[model samples]
Target: MSKLEAGIVDGASAGYGAVACTEATKNPVAVANALLEQGPHVMLVGRFADEANKNFGFEVVTNDHFTTPYRKAYWDQTAAALGQRDSGSEMGTVGAIVLDEHGNLAAGASTGGPTGKVDGRIGDTAVLGAGLSADSKLAVLCSGAGDQIFKHLVAANVAKYHVTGSSIRDAARKALQSISATGASCAMAVIDAEGNAAIESTAKLFSVSWAPASGPSTTGLLPTSFPILPTHTIHQCLRNRITVDRALWGGALCSCHGRRRCLSILPLHGLSKEWHPVTSKEKEFHEEYPGYISSNDGPMMAAEKLDGISSRIRAVSGLTAPFNNRFNGPDEDSKLFARIIRGELGQWRIWEDDHHVAFLTPFANTPGFTVLVPRKHLPSDIFAIKGEEFSALMESAHSVGNLLRQALGTSRCGMIFEGFEIDHAHVKLIPIHRHSEATGTTVTVAPFNHHYQGSVTSLNGPLLKGTASLTLDAAELRKKIPVKTITSPRSWADPPRHLSAVLQEPWYKSLFTIQDALFHDSIAFFQKQLGYKYRAAVIQAVAGTTAHLKSLLELHRSSGGKFPRVTVDDALKLVVMNSNDWRYVVESDTSKGRTLTRDGELKLIQHFGGAVWVTEMDHLSVPFYQAFIDDTQAKARCGDLLLGNGEVLGAGERHVEVKDMLAALEQHQVPAQGYPWYTEIREHKPLLTTGWGMGIERFVAWVFQHNDIRNMTIIPRMKGISFAP
Candidate 1:
């Protein structure tokens, strides 16, 4: 998790390019190279340079050439010259996206709000729901006052508009307008795979005006307060955040007790099912199966005779017991035991004791149905069960499960069993649904039940249909109390390292890679589309092309050092200028008036034309922009980069052209490690778009939306020691 100080930046202000196709693609080196290839009129934004490098460890996307201060200075001077003066207290924001050689696009953003600021002052750059948007092929983001952005639900709206056939610009305008109408001061942009773009702002002449030092300020016009924009919405932002969090964190099952609790016992009878066992009277005369012999003293033995008539159940079904264990004595609750065993007075489906064994009648609701030895505490394990016991257990379980569907009208039945808890073995008769009812499970008992601490509570049961006696069916009893998923200390030490086999598959890798790429691309594109233009000049003295270089030098001299000197510097400027492609804008803490933009430099230059076009002619020493461009385009194509425009560009001549242009722009750009991970197999890919946004404080500050990871887990378990309960 990257931890950058918080603040805000507004797109409604002058610095950003505002809107363009693949606008957020900021690969600095690539962007600079691309700019050299294009005419000088093009500008780029080296957005999020400081924060990205410090926090994310590496650039996911966007150029990393310019610092926040540099970008802010450029915007500040531009605003000043245009008659808009700077207020020192506003936050700095930069949003960027970069495309890798394989066409994967990465997006990210950063911001610093009003200097002496209040906490929780979120800006467009920091808040994902409004700040950034990414998916395979394109990326989009915004920069402006968060309050205003939220009014429009900008990020989500932009995405929606893009999907509905609007160009990046169109969607941005629509989103911005929606919020503007709501009185939110905002600016927005969008970019797509095919180079289509859109940008729109609700207000002009917007400038950062500090809020009162001690109290709040009322909403005002742009340059002061970005009252509202089209795309920001509280509900939408929340929903999107929740969805992201859920995806980031998989099932919350805890390994504390080392058991999965797919189905938890809820205190609701309607949510449970009960079963019964077959009886002698229920079986036909010819369907007899050998039974266990119970002597007058209660000693039990298996019958040796294989009567042609078949045991009580053998004729009708090839069922047998799954396990057998002999105990000399029974618990003091023999009356309760007898009732359960005889299937006469107990409500449970299966029960056993020294005196007898009986199973309650089966029901339509029960599946994988079978009566098994429920309470035989012994050292022997399942391995001891063989031949008839195994066959009977399996056959009965299968038959019962099938019959249950016939009885309950469900398609399948779920079977589960665990010999770890009770001294005895028991088979679970569960009815499976089209979808498993068990969201997850946790095992709380462990290490000889050492963690055991008892909780006493009164039980709840149903009144008999016509009688006053309370009848607690096992299923009902299970539901009457909340069953905790226990975690065993031993299971917590170290889960089996993620199975390498499962991770090695293409599907698994694709899930992460494509998602990441899509996210970066989407965000970068959005920011670029939303940024404003600037006059970028390269202060270079190319050997052979001194005349051409002289012209750039002249332009720079005229701009009063506003232009960059080195190719790298030029690249950085372009990105800073175009950073908003996939970034957001929000107000600084000093006041609601400030909004920010952020992203990569190289990607910026590619999206927005820069001063020079990298010719196959430029010196090799000069970083090539076309290569970066090509890579970015490839990333987009492979869904590694977001398509801000929300439309797919299939491969062919047009795509080829875009690819070439990108390659040219990317030439000479520095490549980073792990860049190839974003690549994917072209033939088999899921129809998905992905991007990542995180809560810096949540991860860094150790405070989560749900308080902590522990709160979100089934059962908290740490290393080595086994906890038993």
Candidate 2:
């Protein structure tokens, strides 16, 4: 026999029994018999019990096999109704009491333990005297609530009564009475040395039978008072079906399957007849506004119109309440924009007009952080506005930047126009402090200083007379500006790092490298000529291009040995680099050779040293609101302020003509239906104007010399993914 079986039997024998059983095993009766033959020991549990059973040659079954249909049904009903399994019930056990002619008496109990009992539970059935007891005078077996039976030592007490000279019947009855006093119920049968037997129970007992040596066996009354496991609840049955379906498919069951099955089973008590994830009106609202509310319309108001939209409304509202709800309505007192317009938000207001307002952000990461918001309700995407309103919006943003610089005691500021959290179009202005504060954390900033060049020269005019001098001798340029080599080895596929490849990386890294290299050269050249830092040195020039300048530069290396021979007119039309895709390269002559690359022997050159302003951008590269420079439609009246690391600000004059707006819209492929109001405003009350915005984080990072923009925001939201607070 296994050590565990031997131990159980030995322990039972030591406690006045010759046999024992455990419901934890597949064949409890067989295990009991094996233990009885194996000899004494106490308990075995968990993995140790399993090992013992294996060694004793007892069949082992999976835990699931022990869950009878009745037990599972009962568990389902109880858990569905009560949200927890019943723990007080006593069931799923059996035992036997025997008397041999040799005057030997034995009692044993076997059980699968309590139904729904947690793993590793050792019940009274395994606790020798608690469930079974035997002596020369009598043998007793008891079954019921394991905890109460174990506490009362029911079997042993009955045996003790018999050994002390009480009749078996009287002893069993008294033991039961003792258990009843404790508010516990149990059933028991007792056998004396004379072969007489008595059965007694405070609770209903299972079937009872007896047979005489010289007579046929007869079955006695079976208890009918015990409650049968209740039928499984509808919710329980539905859950069971879903579980089975998921197991069969090895994936999520279709939501429709659940709904259909549920509907067939019972009525959906709280759901409406017309249920939809998103109703027709909600879809229309989304199509029109995309990311902003229209007028006084909102999700709550929309939900009231739909039969089953409340639940979805609650779900979405719960997730976005902290951010989106703050800008729900123009007159909402809780809205930051509304409070700011009312002069109730922020430390101070910076600027305001009939159509816009600006103020310092209370949760500023930097000393002079400000937010510029439109006075009128507007969508988060500025492109949703049309004609002069777009231009006016840009102008307002530009004014905010200027105001922030003056207010914060700095000549430079960074602005960012992004609708990250709210639905309204807001621009953030971050002042570019000249020097880092002593108490502030370390940050990265652009090393190159800006010397503002005079007014932007018209690119449509002839090239400057000294334009040829701008292309310095490669060998001479190298002597003035030392170029860093790509020391890392490269394969055929991975060529030496070029300006084009460098431009593909994050703007901060690549742009800084280019700016630093050019700045060093410019500083050296000007210092040699002036014998000091030429703070006022500024060079401005205009070059036109017939083809897209950006595309021309990208294809320079592949365009054979010759630079694309451009006519004077081609050079005049500047190809605006929209987004972060544009690359600027200069052909330079070094000690090794002449090459067109960012880090090649010939260094890159900027028309203006400090902040270069370039206008007349390619029409296709800019937004629809940007007005065409002329009827030719080749260039738009848009420009960028190349300051700090790179272009820190962008401004564009908006198109006032409805026809031009339509054409621009077609070029950009924006759905026209969604912009009906914007189109109406453009056609009716158009105003010719311009606007610009700057990135606050980028500007602050540039001023503080911080490489990462993420460090600039207190609760940074990255690519729409938020982290736990």
lDDT of each: 0.34, 0.48
Writing each residue's lDDT as its tens digit, candidate 1 over 26-45 gives 33223322332332423323
Best by lDDT: 2
Residue-by-residue lDDT tens digits, candidate 2, 493-583: 2334432333353333433443453446575354333322222111100111111222322244234422333211232333422223232
TM-score of each: 0.22, 0.29
State the number of backbone clashes in model 1: 220
- State candidate 1's TM-score: 0.22
Q: Model 2, stretches more than 4 Å misplaced?
A: 1-24, 212-216, 222-725
Per-residue lDDT, model 2, residue 65, is 67
